[model samples]
Target: MRSSSVLAIVVVLLVCLFKHGNSVPVEMETTTAMTTEFTATESSRKDIVFNSTEGEMEKPRYPHDGYCGHLEEACSDERRCCPDFECYHSEGRCIYLMQ
Candidate 1:
């Protein structure tokens, strides 16, 4: 019985080899880099605000404590700190709480 099972396994292996041994390797198509002209207008560039003191005071990117509070930044009861952060009133700064 064991010899017959071994013969059946050998037959299956031979069948698989015969089916896949004649398979051809497929050639992949080569990609070519295409160049395109990109023109950016002055108005479009003006929309982005950089690290300017005037711009930060006038228009803050994250209002109402939307962003994470830094160590030096001021935080109070009225102005809550970011997630997993607490307002250290003694130092008047926001601090990250460890889990």
Candidate 2:
């Protein structure tokens, strides 16, 4: 009878250990969450420039060309484009200024 009781105790202890061994899944979940958050932060940063939206910092588009390397000069035309805004080369594409 005593041996049977000891066997029962050992079995209970083994069951507890098996249950605790599942902690690996919990740790993996935590690691995955942290990795996901880090990736999201990096993506968001990449899409931002000067703390402004990506659209605001977009490269200048030229009326004759696509992406203009002379965006600085293109931005100078106040009558055509908005002030303090950037320009990009849009080869042969006309710039539509909001009247």
Candidate 3:
């Protein structure tokens, strides 16, 4: 009877361990998926563009102040910066100018 009890205890412990082990991998997968989604959102923010005619352009509130003087000017891939003059050219690094 004692041996049977010991065997049952061992089986229960084994089942609990197995379940815990499987749960860890599931949690890790969930975390990785969230990280990937956040990265994609951050990259898309950098590539945002606005129509010149919309007149909805606004200067970047952080990092560099004022409009970006040139395409080579310091710009954040996460924030929008207005063009110094007008947005006459095609799609580039320039943002729409504020009216």
Best candidate (score: lDDT): 1
Across 1-99, the per-residue lDDT of candidate 2 in tens digits comes to 999999999999999999899765753433434433444476445433442655356544434434443323443233234323334445422344335
Q: Rate the local accuracy (lDDT) of all candidates.
A: 0.66, 0.49, 0.53
Put the candidates in TM-score order, highest first. Answer: 1, 3, 2
The best candidate by TM-score is 1
- Cα RMSDs, all models: 10.1, 12.5, 12.9
Residue 59 shift from truth in candidate 1, angstroms: 9.9
Lowest-lDDT window of 10 residues in candidate 1? 57-66
For model 1, the local distance difference test gives: 0.66
Quote the positional error of residue 50 for candidate 3 in Å: 54
lDDT of 3: 0.53
Candidates 1 and 3 compared: the better one by lDDT is 1
TM-score per prediction, in order, is: 0.42, 0.25, 0.26
Clashing pairs in 1: none
Candidate 1 backbone overlaps, count: 0
